[model samples]
Target: MGDENVDEIIKDFILLQDDIVIDRYSNGGANGELYFGERKLLSDRVALKFYYYNKDVSTHNEPLILKSIEHPNILKIYDAKIIHQQYAYFLTPEISGGDLKNFKDNNIVSFYDAINITQGILNGLSELHKNPNNLLHRDLKPKNILIDQETKTPYIADFGSVKFISNAENSVVASKSTQIYRPNESVVQNVYNRQSDIYQVGIIFFQLLGGKFPEAPFEWLDDRQKSKFLKISGSEFEKWQFIDSAIDNLIVKNKLLDYDSLPAYINNKVKAVIKTATNKDLNKRYFTCSEFIKDLFDLKKQNKDWRIDNQEIYANKENKKYYRISEDKKGYCLQVSKNQVNWTKDNKHDGTLESIISRIHKD
Candidate 1:
């Protein structure tokens, strides 16, 4: 649990491979500690996830599960082994773009890009659900996803809570970090199924569309309540109080999707997909990953220009630049920024949405 213990354990693993050089510690989450390192012999950068030996079956099964599945959107594991007799560590290629949480907070994800990212996640999830895998990614939050720097592809990472559908009835020890993402059935009955995975992915979809994280007794606060909620944040105790007050003010019951929080530009069809996927009733929800993907893919076919509403940031994955286009009473305004904060006016198009979009692409 201490830093020294981790160092001591990793020292043994490093000795085993003379070329392995531990660069630095990346981060520690509810799952485990991640270290960035490189193999001098192979000239490759890698990530090492260190999990202390525990009774939890998933901790031990993670590496094997990752090894069993092969997909562009899934994290690939090179090796899994017990180290210093106390830790179970797995090696994976280091992803430079970091996780979705950081990316979401920093950049404004475009409409089409959000759909593409969600599709990638669902594609990876499908692999886990297929024949031999039959696995449910119980904890599928933004933090568990890694984004590729070059391609902007989202890779599903963190398999600590992954389990097969056969073990759906088994009680899962939900960490504080994952508790917010738990589906209704998982919370009430200590169960998780294919639908549970669907529920979490739906939440991610909602988030990518500029909606706030829907917390339990999930309902969006009124305009006045939101104004107050924004102002009340300081100490940890105050934060808890804010959360409690927000929950108490919820007039609607069992609302999984916050339709109001979603951008107005989002059509009913896309909203319907999110609603069905995150539906509280297991019967109404998507039964499998393929079912979810079908709806999303259908939407993709129907719409080519999927851009979010005005004033929202859009990151062009091709050039790796931040840009946004907004239509005011006067005309359409396009702004570009290096960092998402300060913007410089790029162009103004008095024409239609298509014309502005054309300027955006050209700029």
Candidate 2:
């Protein structure tokens, strides 16, 4: 639950949570924090985000991410509002227990953990990439990667990570690359291409293998082939060889050598998959999240983690849930949850794609 002024007959939108135990999890983002409640929400015991902003506006891209995505791997956005003049980014199945960074820091992950994240993140991004609308997640980091304790699955958190490409424009370029993202040649060229997302995935995969990067963190190049290996800062580069050797044994050579420091079961095949995925060359990498998923499949098949016994029976359809939100006559909206929709909550122009999608989610 939240301190919402909920005497609403004006909007069809449904709020995801009520006022109960909304507390900050992490000093989320630079200013935001992940909030969890004592009791489950109206839909399910969910997590909510009170995104901070520059001037009394919430900057978290929760609405953008929700607008374009709906998947098991993504933290579901349920509602977004300007309550008490501060932005509250509402989401369903509120994620707790921190992010992937904690898991990586504690080295609490196994091959199963890595594989599930690989699959979930890729599946979520693949859906976003394939979405007819061009939406890019510019910021993908361990901190933004959440895992629900109940399902124990990874959910890509925060929409402040979003970038949208415009079709009407002759030229459009996204903002500067973050320290965490590894830019491909095209992205480095400031081309605002789809490959930027691919580059982000590569960085995440690398972090998955070697933990965190230090100093300058990820490497960015105008060309991956031209730049095979560039100098990086901090203990990250120092540990590169150890990671290199670890990946080499697991991947390229297919040697099932177990690390004295690691569990017995984590061996060659898993390493190889992670290596190829985190490869420096963006072109040499899988272009979309769907293709990247193949690496996990290969790892699972070779290592036997994913199987009929482990996966759900493939059904032709997924359950459909819809909601509504009130926006300015012309603004965007995303279906955050079954009962709530984060309508670009702006009643600006007479219309926005989010408004259109709002209609669809309702239908």
Candidate 3:
């Protein structure tokens, strides 16, 4: 049947179900479409994704994979159904805040907000990486990350390219993965592992920190462009030399001011983290999301006297004392006063503010 006819049938079929299709959300994979919907019984808003059964095994397994995991930062699957063994539908909460790409395009994300969003994504990845079901989100890009309008929290979505690490032997190379965010090892060796996901996260972090992606010469070009360039050049070694030169330029160039022009201390730390995460060697990159989170928190704690201008102040509701933590020329210090604390403690540099707060709360 034609796609138009199939879509019409699916639309009519969905109406018969409990959901009222509000509007078309997006064109999903070649054989699928996403719709903004509302449940008739409860009037609850939802995102309905419909896929033809003949699409691919991954499309059919997407719902099951999502249903297996339950994390706030991960996309929640509300319902699923197979219509007459032809079309499969899966329902999830409608994220009006849209994807990360939209969010980044519309607003100037603060340093703290970037860290928070990246941390949330890392937390979701941690859950996916742990225990019985070791899964790799082979495709982790800004478009696949949805944000909640109210909470401003980011949620990982679109599991169509998810892979089970345990079944690596049986898995085929993901030729369709987004090359911009793909890891070097994966691109060169056709291997997608946990480290590959980490590499994508690193790219996301770089994007969040710097407005533009890291330009590695031919790496930024699409496959077709790269192919044509290589065909004209006739030497793969020339491409490697060009890529190496780009990397060297990035190393020497002072481009940190392009993003938010963050403080030198904060900017250096962020760069260091990105460098480690995006390292070409899988062994050198962050082994787990938890490790990456630790580095981010440590960076947050490392800078002394790093002024967060116009940022929200944290206060203890019970004590009514405003708390501010910052690093200075001396060391890390916590300031507590009626509204803002100016007094600096010179000898309190044991750990990060997060650790200190956790210790104090425990005590």
Winning model by TM-score = 1
Instruction: State every prediction's TM-score relative to the real structure.
Output: 0.73, 0.56, 0.68
Query: Which pairs of residues have clashing backbones in candidate 1?
Result: none
Q: Please provide, for model 3 over 1-363, each residue's C-alpha lDDT reduced to its tens digit, 9 standing for 90 to 100.
A: 223544677767755764474645565433377777677778888887888775555558888988989999999998888875678888888887888877877766655567778889999988887777788888987888998766779999888788777743533355455545656655556677787788788778767653465334565444665665667564778766555544444333322223444332245567778878778776788998989999988865553222244442232323444455566564446655554545433234364655444433332
Least well predicted 10-residue stretch by lDDT in candidate 3:
250-259
Worst 10 residues of 1 by lDDT: 247-256
Ranking by TM-score: 1, 3, 2
Q: What are the lDDT scores of the predictions, listed in order?
A: 0.73, 0.51, 0.67
- lDDT of candidate 1 over 1-363, digit per residue (tens): 234545565656654766678767754545677777788889898988888866554457888888888899999999977764568788899988789988887765777778889999999988887777777788899989999876779999988777666544533433323555767776556667777788899989989887866544223466776677678768868756665445533311346456787755566788889988887788889988888888988876554344554454253534446667667676666677777688897656654555666655455
Candidate 2: tens digits of C-alpha lDDT, residues 47-99: 54555433434364566567557788777766656543344445556565557
* Best model number under lDDT: 1
TM-score of 1: 0.73
Error in Å for residue 139 of model 2: 1.2
- Regions of model 2 farther than 4 Å from truth: 1-18, 23-25, 30-33, 39-45, 52-61, 85-91, 166-177, 210-212, 215-282, 304-363
User: Model 1 lDDT vs. the true structure?
Assistant: 0.73
